[model samples]
Target: MVAPGLRRYPVTMRLLILIALLNLPIDVAAAEDRRVFFGTWGTAKQCAREPIKPGGTFLAEPYEIGDEWLRQGQLWCLLSWGPIEKRPDGYFSGAHARCGEDTVRQYFLGMVLSDGELTLRWGFPASSGPLRQCPRS
Candidate 1:
């Protein structure tokens, strides 16, 4: 009992449709969205130097933002971020949990990306100036 004017495809056509679906491209857009902020950002000197260790010198280390994780040399804070939300003030914000040594801290992150520079503001009265993307070694 077929419905009005609707025709069923043969087995060959069904197989072709399955093959076409399998040949579709991978979810590249999802990958791109996850890596939108994936890069190492810092001053030229920081980018050139090797990553500093925990409890090491207090130099302003660069930030390495990767898929779902971020790392900074100073204090060895490794941050795990939730979804980033776009704000009305031309910035993106997120809530992140940072783990360093024996301490864990939570903060709201506000970031602005322009050109190849990334500016970040978190914590009270603290901010990161314009940091440029590091060159690949």
Candidate 2:
């Protein structure tokens, strides 16, 4: 004979489970901007006050502030990375990050994917670590 108490126990558990599932999601949208730690393996710091510390993860704003490089006289050599939204045609549009009164935007060519790190690059990509996901709350 089945135990009388066991029958009620299963029903009670099911009722509690249903209530929790009905609550559903309560969080920020997926498109919301979030600050996260930007990870990189190799770095070039000839101009930065302190060279970007490698190995250990460093905190950065949600936006991507490309490396600042000024050419002697009148040349520009800058490198930056941002979220890439790939389209059906394989083309992508980068969300332009604004700073002060200027705009931070770049055209991405390709990304170097490895076991660790993702290097976002345009044209011929240089050797750099890949951009990993580190969403900070």
The lDDT values for all models are: 0.65, 0.37
Candidate 2 segments whose C-alpha is farther than 4 A from its true place: 1-108
Score every model by TM-score: 0.57, 0.24
Which regions of candidate 1 fall more than 4 Å away from where they truly are?
1-31, 50-60, 74-91
Q: Per-residue lDDT for 1-137 in model 2, tens only?
A: 88999889989999999877764432122122211222222322312213235553442222233333212112233533344343343323232222221544443334444454445444454433444443332
Tell me how candidate 1 scores on lDDT: 0.65
